[model samples]
Target: MILVDSSVWIDYFKGVHNAQTEHLDALLDNPEEELAVADLVVFEVLRGFSSQRTKREAQTLLLTTQVVEIGGLDNALLATEHYRLLRQKGYTIASPIDVLLASYCITHGHDLLHRDADFDVMETLRGLRTWPH
Candidate 1:
């Protein structure tokens, strides 16, 4: 399974042309491909919805995707270690949420599809597979 990050979705929704968006679109085109999204990802991506109705619509889209909550017992220790390791390397993750998601992907053996540099750095810290789209 692949965990999609906010960057590619943002670009796709805004009609931004890039190698990343094309890659994402191609993935979506495959009939058998499965896409994954966490609950926190919806908050990050759909915060732009201006009205309650729009927010609800965006939420509906998100609910159609899979939701995985990270950092219960098995992942928290790994996440903290990832946070410290990335910080030591001087790569800014910018949020605890990112760390949680990255850790989830790492522990679950899921590849991350993202253009964000944070995930790039997290790969080194967490040994998670990343698909830079």
Candidate 2:
């Protein structure tokens, strides 16, 4: 399964039409591709919608995919460890949330589809798989 990150989802909802969004669109079109959304990603995407209607629509769209629940003690500890490791490697992630997302993806063996640079860093340092692989 591929975890769709909020970065790509945001661009897709806005009809941004970039490579990442295009890739997401293609994935949505293909029945063989399994798509998922981490709970944090769902919150990140839905919370940004300005209107209730839009938020509901966004929720509906996200509901089509599997919702991966993260944030248990084990996952949080793993995320913290990954963050420390990245820091020791002279990398500073802007959001700890990204660490949690990456950790969840790593643990579940799900490839991520993201436009965020933080995920790229995670991919390099932690063996996080990315789509279009």
Candidate 3:
């Protein structure tokens, strides 16, 4: 399964014409490709929409994908470890949320579909996989 990141989702919702959005559109059309989303990603995407109608629409669309539950303690520690390791390697991610998302993908053995550069850094620093293999 591929975890769709908020960065890609945001661009998609805005109807932005980009490679990442196009890839996501293709993935949505392909029945063989399984898409997933984390709670944090959902929140991040939905929270940006000020309109209730848009928020509902986004929620409905996101619900079609598998929602990966981010559990406590163990996952938090793992995220922290990932962040620490990356920082030690002289890599700085803009958000802790990105680390958590990468940790979730790593823990679940799922590929990530992201437009953000931070994921690229994680892919290099760690073994985080990105879609299109």
Better of 2 and 3 by TM-score: 2
User: For candidate 3, which ten residues in a row score worst on lDDT?
Assistant: 66-75
Model 3: runs farther than 4 Å from truth? none
* Candidate 1 residue runs with Cα over 4 Å from true position: 51-57, 71-73
| 20-123 per-residue lDDT for model 3 (tens digits) | 89999999888898998888889899999999999999999999988987656788899999998998999988987888889988988999999899999999
Q: What is the clash count for each candidate, in the order shown?
A: 1, 0, 0
Per-residue C-alpha lDDT of model 1 across residues 5-100, encoded as one tens digit per residue: 777776766679898878778776774767687667777888876778866865775566567777486777888888887778777688777788
Per-candidate local distance difference test: 0.76, 0.91, 0.90
The best candidate by TM-score is 2
- Clash pairs, candidate 2, are none
C-alpha lDDT of residue 74 in model 1: 70
Tell me how candidate 3 scores on lDDT: 0.90
Q: lDDT tens string, model 2, 23-69? A: 99998899899999989888999989999998999899899988988
- Models ranked on TM-score: 2, 3, 1
Candidate 2 worst ten-residue window by lDDT: 65-74
TM-score of each: 0.82, 0.96, 0.95
Candidate numbers, best lDDT first, in rank order: 2, 3, 1
